[model samples]
Target: MAKNLIQVIIAGGRVVGQAFTRALKQEYEASQRAAQRAGGGNQGRKSAANDTFTGMSLQEAKEILNVSDITDAEAIQKSYDHLFGVNEKSKGGSFYLQSKVVRAKERLDIELQSHSKQKRTDQPPDT
Candidate 1:
């Protein structure tokens, strides 16, 4: 009788274990499918970045500033000021337009800073 009870307990344990294992496998496969549909596992994170500024890039920022050279701080600032002024909310300007210009300017600043940092890191130290 005791041997029969032990066997039943072991079988019950195996059944419970298999149920959990199958559930975990299903969850993992669902996540994999979701990731594939999103392009990759990191696609969600990339989209979050894109959503921040309407998917604006460094080149787009430069274009919005209308600067032929992004390195020209004066020109970039002048263009930003001009665009910002024309889009002022109190001056009957479109607030949405003003916000876009602001985002572009901010994006360019971040890009410029990142590039400068990269250059500094790439250069050899002075003797």
Candidate 2:
């Protein structure tokens, strides 16, 4: 009778252990599927639309810097420096200003490059 009881206890433990493992596996698989669905849910749409950096527009940057135009690299750089200096002194300001400076610089640089490219493209082809 004792041997039979021992056998039953051992079998029950094995069954319970297997059930726990199966439950964990199912949970892991469900999480993986959820993650995959999220990652592949939107392909055609702009990924930046929901991004944190998308909150700040170029127009807002220009207004914040008090510049009528961002075509001048010197002006952009000065504005960036001033903002960064202010950020350094104030603990209350958001670090978003640093990101804005980066975005402003990128926009200006890209515009300059495109302008130069257009000029080169418009020139007469080599003889």
lDDT of each: 0.75, 0.62
| Candidate 2: segments with Cα more than 4 A from true spot | 1-57, 89-92, 125-127
Q: Please give, for residues 26-113, the per-residue lDDT of candidate 2 as tens digits.
A: 9877655544543544421222222223444445556666676656768877887787777662656567776666665555555445
Q: Give lDDT: candidate 2, residue 106.
A: 58
Highest TM-score against the true fold, candidate: 1
Measured by C-alpha RMSD in angstroms, how accurate is candidate 2?
A: 10.6
Q: RMSD for each model, in Å, please?
A: 9.4, 10.6
Query: What's the lDDT for candidate 2?
Result: 0.62
Q: Would you estimate the TM-scores of all the predictions?
A: 0.55, 0.42
Candidate 1 on 25-104: residue-level lDDT in tens?
Answer: 99888766645553566754343344344557555777788876766778889999999999898899999888879888
Clashing residue pairs, candidate 1?
none
